[model samples]
Target: MSFQGYLKTIKEKTGKGPEDFQALATEKGFVRDGQLQVKATEVTNWLKADFELGHGHAMAIYALLKGLKDQHSQ
Candidate 1:
């Protein structure tokens, strides 16, 4: 699926927005200078275990990295 599709799916599943999770992640120190570690598989595992994110939500971040999701970055 596309990045936006992943985002929309996550929103549908979790009832939250990208910024919502971004903020949560920021509060949790999962980021540094607006970047997370690349390692796609590791990221997915982290999301599932730490953030309770499912496949779709984890894929949203991947899509963002692949330039398939939101183009704007904070």
Candidate 2:
């Protein structure tokens, strides 16, 4: 799916748009400092349990997070 499609799916699951959830993440420092290191398996499980996101969708979220993190690094 395209990036927009991934974002839409994330909205449905997270009940918030990218900016909204991202603001929360930023407050938590997930996108601060430099590197973005997270437990992929843990995120996968959380998405599955909390949002009912399938593997592909969950992976998309992971990609989006990584992308956003990268944007802050530069």
Candidate 3:
């Protein structure tokens, strides 16, 4: 799937957009001051365990959190 497609599916499954996940990531200390503070694995693990997201969807959120991707981008 495309990057945006992953984001759309993630939002559909979790009822959360990138911003919401950013907030959650901040709360988890995976993000700090709008920057990612941990490794991708840690962030992905949290996403997978908590949201039941598969690796690809979790990585999509990770990209958003890490400022590697944006919600509207393809």
Worst 10 residues of 2 by lDDT: 65-74
TM-score, model 1 to reference:
0.60
User: Top model by TM-score, which number?
Assistant: 3
Instruction: Report the error of model 3 at residue 50, Å.
Output: 0.4
Which of candidates 2 and 3 is the stronger one according to lDDT? Answer: 3
TM-score for all models, in order of appearance? 0.60, 0.60, 0.95
User: What is the lDDT of every predicted structure here?
Assistant: 0.65, 0.61, 0.89
Location of the lowest summed lDDT over 10 successive residues in candidate 3: 65-74
Q: Tens digit of lDDT per residue, candidate 3, span 1-74? A: 99989988998999999889989988988788888999999988998999999998988888888788788888
- Once fitted onto the true fold, the runs of candidate 3 whose alpha carbons sit more than 4 angstroms away are none
Q: Say which candidate scores most in lDDT.
A: 3
What TM-score does prediction 2 earn? 0.60
> What does the lDDT read for residue 31 in candidate 1?
53
Candidate 1 per-residue lDDT, tens place, 1-74, comes to: 55566676777867877777666655655655677545667667867886688877787765564445573443
Error of 2 at 29 (Å): 7.6
lDDT of 2 by residue, 15-66 (tens): 8765664455456555555333565675567568767888887666565556
The residue pairs that clash in candidate 3, if any, are: none
Which should have the higher TM-score, number 1 or number 2?
1
The deviation in Å at residue 63 for candidate 1 is: 4.8
